[model samples]
Target: MKDNIIDARGRACPEPVLLTKKGVEASPNGVKVLVDNVTARENIKRFAKNSGYEVKVEENGEGILLTLSR
Candidate 1:
């Protein structure tokens, strides 16, 4: 299982979710998404969850970290 990281900070709306989807499609094992705002964080989490992946979120000074695993 490989871990893929998608940095989506400062990006708006669907961009973050899109990157997350791409990362997940590329690496089904795990995906770490870095987002700057609450909206992006929630959106990515929801997308991952709805796609059958387990979501874990962590708060950081720069932004939020979403760890998605299958």
Candidate 2:
């Protein structure tokens, strides 16, 4: 696991979103969040966008990779 990477693959709903919030807070430059489900990906994407960040999404094996940056 990387310091700027949040692995929320096995988690669900609010947990993934919450982890992403924290990750973004801690990483001033950017944050990379990993989630295995669509819900988490969408939720995090919306949250990041609402919070004034740019989200870059991509497929990561069996999961999704969301990269948030200001």
Candidate 3:
């Protein structure tokens, strides 16, 4: 399966979540979302979990990487 990446870093709130939702809907395999803030990271994780996708998070110096897989 191919992985789709959504770069949401430097963006605020719902924008990241919205981009992630779009990416998830467009990609059958999975989506990787990059967010620089805690709020965006948590929001995306919550959104993905509630949408029935398996969520994983990785912390980095720049930001967090959220992996949403079905």
Candidate 4:
């Protein structure tokens, strides 16, 4: 089954990424994280990559969608 989704909009620098990290830790399969800032997107991408999860990031309107699968 697909894991959880984390919507981290309106949250400033690092919070989104931090929350995403927590979501990743909580998931046995993986998770999808949505963030509206470039920095947050990059941070999640870096974390996912470093953690060895397969990641896909897409542009959704003004926000970014990150799908992580382990």
Return model 4's CA RMSD, one decimal: 1.5
**Clashes in model 1: which pairs?**
none
TM-score, structure 4 vs. true: 0.86
Candidate 2 CA-lDDT value: 0.88
TM-score of each: 0.92, 0.90, 0.91, 0.86
- Total clashing pairs in model 4: 0
Candidate 3 residue lDDT tens string, 3-43? 67789999988899999988977895689998999999889
lDDT per model, in order?
0.89, 0.88, 0.88, 0.85
Q: Could you tell me which 10 consecutive residues in candidate 2 have the lowest summed lDDT?
A: 1-10
What is the full ranking by TM-score, best candidate first?
A: 1, 3, 2, 4
User: Per-residue lDDT for 1-70 in model 2, tens only?
Assistant: 2448889999969999999888877886679998999999999999999999899999958689998988
The better-scoring model by TM-score among 2 and 3 is 3
Model 4 per-residue lDDT tens digits across residues 1-70: 3758899877987898789788977885789988888888888889888988888988878578899998
Evaluate residue 22 in candidate 1 and report its C-alpha lDDT on the 0 to 100 scale. 87
**Winning candidate number (TM-score):** 1
What tens digits encode model 1's per-residue C-alpha lDDT throughout 1-70?
5557789999999999998888888887878999999999889888988999998899989689999988
Model 1 ranges off by over 4 Å: none
RMSD of 2: 2.3
Pairs clashing within candidate 2 = none
